[model samples]
Each structure stands twice: as C-alpha cells, then as structure tokens.
Target: MAQHALVTGSSHGLGAHLAARLAADGWKVTGLGRRPASETPGTPGVDHLQADLSRPETLERITDRLGEAPDLIVHNAVSYPPRPAHELSLAELEDVFRVNALVPYRLTLDLLAATPDTRFTSIVVINSESMFHADRDSGAYAASKAALRVLTGSLADACRSRNTAVATLLLGPLADPDKVAQLQRVAARRGVDEAEITRVFLRKSNPDLVIEELIDFDACYRSVQYLAGLGRAANGMLCRLDGGSAGSLI
Candidate 1:
C-alpha cells in the first residue's frame, strides 16, 4: 500500500508546498485547511479537507475524511499576530495559542486515538526560530510556538514506544511573498535596499554560518522529506534548519 500523509494549514505557504511535494513523491496526501480544497493551492492528487482547527470539534470528522491512517503527519498550521508584548491582549494571545498550540495538540491526540493499531512512522512539527530568538513585536507568536515545541517533546516521548519518529523543524524566516513584502517595508523605513537589509540580517544573525541566508519553501520541503524518511534510530530528534542562525540559541 502507498504511504499516506496528512498536512495541516495546506492552503498556502510551506504547507501547500509540502503537500504538492509529497504528492509528487507518490504519497497519498490529505491537506487540511480552513479554505475549500478547490481554493487551496495543491497538487492534482492531494485530498483537501476543509476544517477550522481552532474549533476543536471540527477535527472530529478528520479520520472519516482520511480513508486510512496517515503514515506521516505534519502540523504546519500557525496563527501569527504581529503585536508587541505590551500591546498583546488576552484574547489575541488566546486566539494565537488556540490555533498554533492547542489545535495541533488536540488534532494529534485525535489521530492517535483513532488509529490505535496503526503505527505512524513520522510526525513533523513545523516550528519557528521565534521559539528561541525573540523577534520584536512578535511575542505572542513566539510564546505559542514555544508551547508547541514543548508539546512536540511530549508527543515524541509518548510515541517512542510505538517507534513513531517525531521531528521538530526549527525554521528561520521563509522567503515567501509576505515575508519579502515585510522586508521591503523595513528596507523602505531604513532607507536601504531589501538585499542589503537581508545581508546585514544574515551577517548579524550567524556570521559563521555557511549555508544560504534565508529559508525557502524548497528547503522546508526537503527537510520534511528527510525527516519523514529517517529510520527508527533518529526518532525524537530536533532538526534545526534555520540556516545555522539558531546555532547557540538552540
């Protein structure tokens, strides 16, 4: 039988890219997102399940949507509110945490419960570098990611007995269009080009790093593929792919 994979937040960004890549790799991919599957950018073979993860009840029908248990589960859904620590309200914090941390926790539990006899080979959590390096005006996002990171550890421990590998991909700033636009705005404010700003960021973040400055969608997809292909020996490993910028912080 072909391997099946479930990827959350598959409407766009890294999640969409991973779903398409997995489909290209011959995995039966199911993409879960708030938007309809037709609206979500995915490969021809991917199955799209529209559900709001923040509402825990929406996940109850996930197993039915997916005909079989997933061999690989990638939690890539996230809520990012660019608010400073002092400006963050309780409601905003709760909203961010609900989507980023609580939803993933509940979804994973549901998956594990529904597939008690089936062994999942890999569970990849798409974490952020914000978990370690605190970016200005992103405290809420960072805090939620930190909670998810902790949850990843707990899930790994729980799945160890079943030989289910859990890998956390600590990613840096992805070169998505939104990120590029943000960089452009910052560059405009600093009276410099975006390229120069990126260069300075890379130099200041990790001067000794030898890899590329930014993490792109391709890099994330390859990392997930590698993590999902790991043998039992590499279970419960934290794979940092932040272009070596998280050197000392991690």
Candidate 2:
C-alpha cells in the first residue's frame, strides 16, 4: 500500500513543491490550503483540499474527511506580519499565533483524537531560523515561530512512545519561486531588470534579509524528505537548513 502524506499550505511555494515531489516518489499526497488547486494549477498527482487552517471549524471537518490516517504529516503553513512587536494590533497577533502555532497543534491533536490507535510514522514541521534570531521589525513573526518550535518539541515528547519521527526543519530565508515569478512579470511590464526589482523589494520588505543566504525550493524539499524518510531513531530532531551561517554555537 502506498504511504499517504498530508501536507498543509500546499497551494503554492515550498508546500506545493514538496507535495509534488512526494507524489512523484509514489506517496499518496493530499494538499490542504485556503486556495483551491485549480485556481493555482497544483501538481497533477497530488489531491487538493481547500481549508483555512486558522478556522477551527474547517480543521474539524478536514479531520473528519481524512478517512485513513496519514503515514506522514507536513505542517508548512505560516503567517508572517512584518511589523514591529509594539506596533502589531491585537487582531494581527491573534492571527499570527493561530496560524503559525495553534493550527498545527489543533490539527495533530484532532487527528490523534479521531483515530486513537493511529500512530503517525513521521511529522515534519517547516520552521524558521527567525525563531532563533530575533528581528526588531519581525518580532511577532519570530515569537510565533519560536512558539511553534517549542510546541513541536512537546509533540515529539508526546509521540515518543508511538515511535513517530517528529522533526522541525529550521529553515533560513527562502527565495520563493512564486514570488520571483511575480516580480519577473512586474519587471517585464516596467521594462526593468528583475535584479533591480528584487533589490527594491528587499529594501522595502524584510530587514537584514540577504538574498545570498536564501535557500531555494529544491533544497527545502531535500531536507524535508530526509527528515520524513528517517526511522524512529531520528525522532525529536531539529534539522537546521541555514547555509552554515548560524554555526554550531546555536
């Protein structure tokens, strides 16, 4: 029987790439996202389910819809608000925490509750290096990710007896292909080079964000796959994907 995998935030970017790659590797893949796959033109072999992870009702329905327990579960959804911690509104803080930390916690618990005997083989959380390194502008985002990291560790402990390989891919900055393509289109319309556009975007957007350290989509796939494919021995592992910049001191 084919191993079934449930990947969240699969509408586009890294989630979409990972889901496609998993499907190609003969795993039965189901992708969950707020947007429908048809609108974004998702991978052919992977099944798509429309879901708003921030909504508890939607999450409950999704758990019910999942007939069989998935062998693997990938939590890749994130909510990033690039504002100072003091400037973040109550609504914004709530949103960031709900999507980044609460959703994954709720979803996993729901699955386990729905099927008491179901023991997931692997659980891969797409985390961020921001969790370790704090930024003045993106403090909320960093805090939320930090919460997720702690939650993932707690989950690892909870599932230790089940022999589930729970791991967090502590990713660095990523040059999302979807964002790049969109910028390319904008550049074409403005009759300017994409590099210039990228520079302006970096300047106006994330602070201290260097394009050089940004990992591509394929690298993320390899890291995620490596963690997911590991046996029980690799449980509670924190695999850092930063390009050796953070160093072993972390």
Candidate 3:
C-alpha cells in the first residue's frame, strides 16, 4: 500500500520542508495549514488544506480534507506571540494555550481515537527547546509547549502497549525566514540593533555540537521513522534539535 502523510503547518519552515521531503520519499503527502502549501513555488506531490490549528474546528476541517485516514501524521504548527509576563493579556495567554498546547493535543487524541490501526503507524509532535527549559519572559509560550511535550510523552505511554509509535522532536531556535522576521521584530521592539540581536541568538544557541544541530527535515523524518519501526511504540525523544543534547532538558 502507498504511504499517506499528513503534515500540519506546511505553508512554511520545517513543515514545508518535511512535506516536500516526504513526497520525495514516495509518500502521498497532504499539508494542513492556514495557507496553502500546494501553491508553493516548486513543490510537487503535495496537497494542502487551509486549516488554522488555533481554531477548535481545525481538526474537523482537516478531517474533512483528508476524506480518508492517512498513514503518517506530524504536528508542527507553533504559535509564538510576544509573551512578556508583565504586560501580556488573558486573551494572549489563552490563544497561546489554544495553539501551542490544547489544539495539538486535541488533534492527536481525537485523530488517534478516530484512527485505530497499526497500519496507521506514526505520530510526531514538534516541541521546542523552550519546552524543557523556562525563560523568565516566556511564561505563556514556554508553558504551553511544555504541556505539549508532556502530551507527547503521554501518547508514547498509551501507544507503547499497542505497538504504535510516538515521536517528539524538540527544536531549538530555527533559522528560517519567519524566525528572522521575529528576531527583527524583537530588535525593533527592544531598540536593539539587528546585528546585536543576531549575535545574542547565536551565542545562546552554542551547543556542544553545533554542526549536528539544525537538523534537516529529511533527518527529522528519519528520526520519526526510526521510532515508528522500533515496535517499542514509545521511543524517539529529541530534547534539543540543537545537537540532540539532554542538557537542554535540564
């Protein structure tokens, strides 16, 4: 049977890259996001749906788009608004929870419950470096992702007995265009030079193995596949995409 892959947040960043890579790997790929990934400049063998994961109805929208179940599922959409502790509002915090914690969780359980079969295979959740370690100002963003990491663990526990797969990929700061834009916005807001901001970011990203960090989407896919094939069902925990270090979790 042909492999069917579903990737959320495929309009850009690692999501887009993974979608394309899965297609190249000969899977029938479908993308879910607010924007359309199929309209992307040179992407072939990928289909997309305009489903905003922040909304409660999004999973249903995705299910409607799928028409039938897919074999592989990856949740990669992240919502990172300015999460200043002193000034952030209730709405902002709730939105962060909705997107970062609740939505992915709801989708995972609902999707898995709705889709029951070993043939369905793997489910991958994307967490961030911030998910493990907390920053003073990252209350909302970090808390939600931390919860997501917990849920990834929960799924691993629940699926392990059934011989299913659950994978968690903890990311460090990404160097994609959106991350650059976010950095620029931070610089503007803080009245700092863009170069200074870049320097700070790089310094903070220094790991024991810099070259091994910033793993490509193909590598990300392989990690998930490894976990899936292990029959352990509850394996493949990536604490920091920056060098795959356990230090980040501490």
Candidate 4:
C-alpha cells in the first residue's frame, strides 16, 4: 500500500495544492477540513473528511473517521485575520488559537494513540515568518502561530521515543493576492494609500523580500516533502523556507 498522508485545511489554497502534489507523488492522501468535497473542488485521488476543527464534538470523533493512522500528518490548517493585539477580542483570540494551535496538538495525540508502536511517522506543522517576527497589525495571528511553534517543539520531545517525528516550517512571504487585498482593505480603513500599507507590511514582515518573485506553492511543497521524508532525523527541527531572506536574519 502507498504511504498514507492526512492533510488538514485541504479544501483550498496551499493545503489543497499540497494534497494534490502528495497524491500525484503516489501517497494515499486524505484531506480533513470543514468543507465537503462535493461542494468544494478537490484533487481527483484525494479523500476528504468534513469536520469543523473548532467544534469539540466533531474533533472528539475525528479519529473514528480515519480507518488507519496516517504515516504523515500535515497540519496546514490556519486561522489568521489581520488584527492588532489590542483590537483582538478574547472570543476571537480563542477561536483563532483553537484552529491554529490547539487543533494540531489534539490531532497529534489522537493519531499517536491510534497508531501501533511498530510504525514510525512524521508530522509537519506549517507556519509563517510571523511566528518569529512580530507585526503591529497581525500581532494576534503571530502570537497564535508562535504558540503553535512551541507546541510542535513539545510534541517533538514527547513523541520522539514513539518514533513520531515532528517539525515546524517557518515560511516567508508567499505570492498571495488575497493577503495583498486584505492589506488594501486595511489601508482603506486607515485612510492611507495602498502602496504605503504594502510598503510598511513588507518592511516589517520581510524587508529583503523580492517583491517581483515571492515564494510559490511549488517551492513550499518541495520543502514540505523534504521535511516529511526526513522522518526521525528531523524531530524537533524548525526549518525555515524563506529563500535566504528572513531565514538568515538574526
């Protein structure tokens, strides 16, 4: 049988791309997300599980849906809205943290418990540069991602003896038009020009970012696959996929 891989947040965007790539590479891929596969288009060979990570009832029974524990679990699901720390409400913070950090932590435990001791697996946690660098507007999202980094480290420590390797990827800026548009909306709200907001965002998030060519899905997928194949050797590793820009920074 092909190596089984379970990817969270695979309904769309980066998660979906990664799922497709994995399936194409001969891995049996299962996608877990809130959206049903019928309503949301997915890769041809990928299986999807519809579950809202925020709901405890659904999360509690998620393991029941997977017939076999996955050899690779990709925690690609994320909840990030551009909000300042002072503006983020407690409810909103909890909701973001639940999806971003808590879900991965819970799923790791659940999957490990279901797995037999004879098998070794890998868990890849997708993160952003914000995990290490703080931003003024996106502070709340950064904090949650930072929390995820810590949790992944703890998991690496706890699961090493069980032959479960865990790693976190701190990615630099990607070519996301949606994120640019989100910043544009913020600029509108602040009565500032879009260019000014974009400039400031680049300055803070990735000062050396090559504006013409940001990280693409292909590069990101390559990183994920590389880390996934490393297995036990990569436990507790924090790999940076920032193209020598932010990764090299002090």
Candidate 5:
C-alpha cells in the first residue's frame, strides 16, 4: 500500500507545492487549508480538507476526515504578517500563535491519539530562518516560529517511546515571483544586477555558506521527502533547507 501523508496549509506556497509533489510521488496526500477544495493544488489523487488553522475548533474534524493515522504529517501552515515588535497588537500576536503554533500542536496530538493502532513514522514541521535570526518588522512572526521550533523538540521527545521521528525544516526565502520582483527592486536601488545583489546579501548575512542563495519550492519538497524516508531511526533532527543561511548564522 502507498504511504499516506497529511499536509496543512496546502492552499498555496510551499504547502501546496509539497502536497502536489507528494501526490505525484505516489503518496496518498490529504491537504488541509481554508480555501475551497477546488482551489487547492492540482494533484489527481490528493484530498483537500478545508479548515482555518487560526480557529482551533475547525481542527476537530481532522481525525474524522482521515479515518486513520497518516504515515507522515507536514505542518506547513503559518500566519506571517509583517509588523514591528512595538506595533504588534494583542490580537495579531494571538492570531499568529494560533495558526503557527497552537494548531500544529493540537493536530499532532489529535492524530497521534486517534491512531493508536497505526504508527506515525515521521512528522515534519516547516519552519523559517527567522526562528534563528529575526528580520526587521518580523518580531511577531519570528517569535511564533521560534515557539514552533521548541514545540517540535518537545514533540520529538514525546514520540521517542513510540519510535516516531520528528524533523524541523528551516528554510530561507523561496524563489517566487513576488520575491523575484522584490529582489529586482533592491538590485535597481543598489545599482547592481539581481544576482549580484542576492550574492551580496547572502554573503553579508553569512560568509561560511557555499550553498545556493535562494531555496525553491522543489528544494523544500525534496527535503521533506528525505526526512520522511528516514524512518524511525532518525529521531529528532533540525534539517536546514535554507541553502546554508542557518549555517552562517549559527
């Protein structure tokens, strides 16, 4: 039988791409997001579960929808609103934590409890480089991600007796159209080519890095796949798919 995978925040970005890629790789994929099922990524065998992670109540239906435990669970849902530390409101902080940390914790526990008979081989949490180095106006987002990273460690400890492996992926800025446009603007402002600007930024951030500057969606998918393939022997591990960004900082 093919392995089953559950991916949260599969409506767009890395989650959507990862879900589609897993489906194409012959894994039975279930995507959870707020968008309508039809709007999810194009994968013929994938099932889309519509839920808003910001609301804890919506997550109650996850176990009912799966009917069984999945082999791999990827927590990729996140709320990223750029605001300075002083400008962050209570509501905004709560919202970010709800989606980034609380929902993933609840869902992981729910699935683990619901699937007593089945073994969850791996749980992958999608994290950001900001968890280590917070950028300007990203205090709230960084704090939430840092919390998620800590949660990943705690979850890994809890799963040790059950032989379930947990992996946290720290990723850098992905190569997308919006990011490309932003890079272009920076390039124009610095009077340098986009490639040169990217190189300079990466070098300035971390001089020890030899990997590529930008991480793409496919890189994220492949990294998750590698984690899932590690079986139960891997245990708790922090895997960086950031193209050496984290290596430079720490």
Candidate 6:
C-alpha cells in the first residue's frame, strides 16, 4: 500500500520539498499550512489542507479535514527573524514556538491517539543545525529547536512502547529556499547587487546531500530525499535548493 504522509508548513520550503519527494516515492502526500492557496507550493497530487495549527479551535477541523491518520508525518514549519534571547517578549517567543515546535508536539499526540491500533508509522521531523550550535542572535530559534529535540526523544520513547517508528531529518541548511526575491530585496537595501547576493546564497546552501550534525534522528530515512524532481529544477518553476551554512533556515 502507498504510505500516507502529512507535512506541515507545506505552503513552502522544506515542507514543500518533502511533500514533493514523498509523492514521488508513491506515498500520498498532504500539505498543511495556514497560508492561502496563492501562497501554497505547487506539489502536484499533494492534498493541501490549510489550518492554523496554533489555534486550539481549529484542531477538530484539522482532524476532520485530514480524513485519516497518516503513516508518515513530517514536521517542517519554520520561523524567521528567529527569536532573540534577551528581548524575546512572551508573545514573540511563543509565536515561533506555536508553529515551529508546539503545534508539531501537540499534533503528534493527536496523531498517535487517533491511530492507536497501528503497529508503527514512520515519523520524520525537520530539526535545525542551530540545535547543535547557536546561530548569531537567534537564541529563541535555538531554544525552540532544542526543546523540540527533547520532545522528539520523549515522543520516540512514548511511541517505542507502542511500536511506532520515528525518524528526524536534521538539516544544516537547506540548499533551496522559496525566498529568492525577498533575499534580493534585502541585498538591494544593503546596497549590494543581486548577483553578488546569489553567489553568497549558493555558498551558504548545503553542499552535502545530507548532513548528520544538523538533524536529530532517533531513526533514519535511508534515501536521497531531494524536495522535488528534476523537472522542477530544470524548468525553474520552483527554487528548492539547499543553502550554505548561513541559510535563512530556522
């Protein structure tokens, strides 16, 4: 049977790539996000479900809309301008956690409870390199990922007793991103040309197909997991390249 997979933050970036990759593997991929259709990534055959994971009220609807428990689930949402350590207001900190960490944590509980009878489901999470090394001025991002890493262990423990499978995809930096235009804008503001910015972006994208340090995995996915197939890259419909070490990956 084709495995059913759910990927959060599927509106773009890592979630988008995982959705496309899984679909290519013959799994039924579902993309979940709060963004409108225009903002969503174009992953053909992926069922897109948009619901704000932060709100408690929408969960029931999320469950209703998801239709069935997934065999695989990838938590890949991210936050930008990652939380600062000292000045992070309660809202500022919690806002990132709500999407990047907390929702994924809670959703795992719901997913497991909803599918109690299953012997195992392949679970994958997208974690940060920052969890290993602190990024400059991004303590909140590091903390959020670190907390999730702990939670991943906890959930793996919880599921180990239940015979469910879990894997974590730790990323050093994504080679590809959907924010080229935004990056270019920032470069312009800094009085730098866009070509120079492009060169800088390439250098920062991950050179390796996979890196061990950045992701936290209790188990592993034994395959080369590119976000999209060649057509997406060749035609330039979407830019899902990995980034150098300093990628805007959070």
* Highest TM-score model number: 5
Q: Relative to the unseen true structure, what is the C-alpha lDDT of residue 135 in candidate 5, on a scale of 0 to 100? A: 66
Q: How much is the lDDT of residue 105 in candidate 1?
A: 79
In the range 1-250, model 1's lDDT, one tens digit per residue, is 7789999999887899989999988998899888886788757878888988767577677777787778889999988775686687887778789889988877787777667544656788999877666666767787899999899889878877775777898887678878678778989999998888877767776564446456789989998988888855446788888776666645
Ordering by TM-score: 5, 1, 4, 2, 3, 6
Where in model 5 is the C-alpha error above 4 Å? 184-193, 201-212, 247-249
* Worst 10 contiguous positions by lDDT, candidate 6: 229-238
Error of 4 at 153 (Å): 0.4
lDDT of each: 0.80, 0.80, 0.71, 0.83, 0.82, 0.64
In candidate 4, stretches whose alpha carbon ends up further than 4 angstroms from where it belongs are 177-205, 208-212, 244-250
| Candidate 4 residue-wise lDDT, 1-250, digit = tens | 8999999998887888889999999999999887887865667779999988867677888898888999999999988764677788888788789999998998899899999978988899998777666767777888888889889989999986888889988788775657877987999999998878876887665766655345678888998889888978889997887755554553
lDDT of 2: 0.80
Give the 10-residue window scoring lowest on summed lDDT in candidate 3.
206-215
Shift in Å, residue 209, candidate 1: 6.8
TM-score of each: 0.86, 0.83, 0.79, 0.85, 0.88, 0.70
Q: Provide the clashing-pair count of each candidate structure.
A: 0, 0, 0, 0, 0, 14
Better of 1 and 4 by lDDT: 4
Question: In candidate 6, what are the lDDT values of residues 31-81, reduced to their tens digit?
Answer: 998797678766787898887766657666776688788877778777754
Off by over 4 Å in 2: 82-84, 114-120, 178-213, 245-248
lDDT (10s digit) by residue, model 2, range 67-162? 887888899988777578889888878888988998897788766555444455688998987765676787898899989989989988987777
| 72-143: candidate 3 lDDT, tens digit per residue | 788888887774755788887777788787887777776667676655467778877665455677767878
Candidate 5 lDDT tens digits, 117-162: 3465689999988766676677788889989988888988888788
**Residue 175 lDDT, candidate 3, scale 0-100:** 64
| Model 2: how far residue 102 lies from native, Å | 1.1
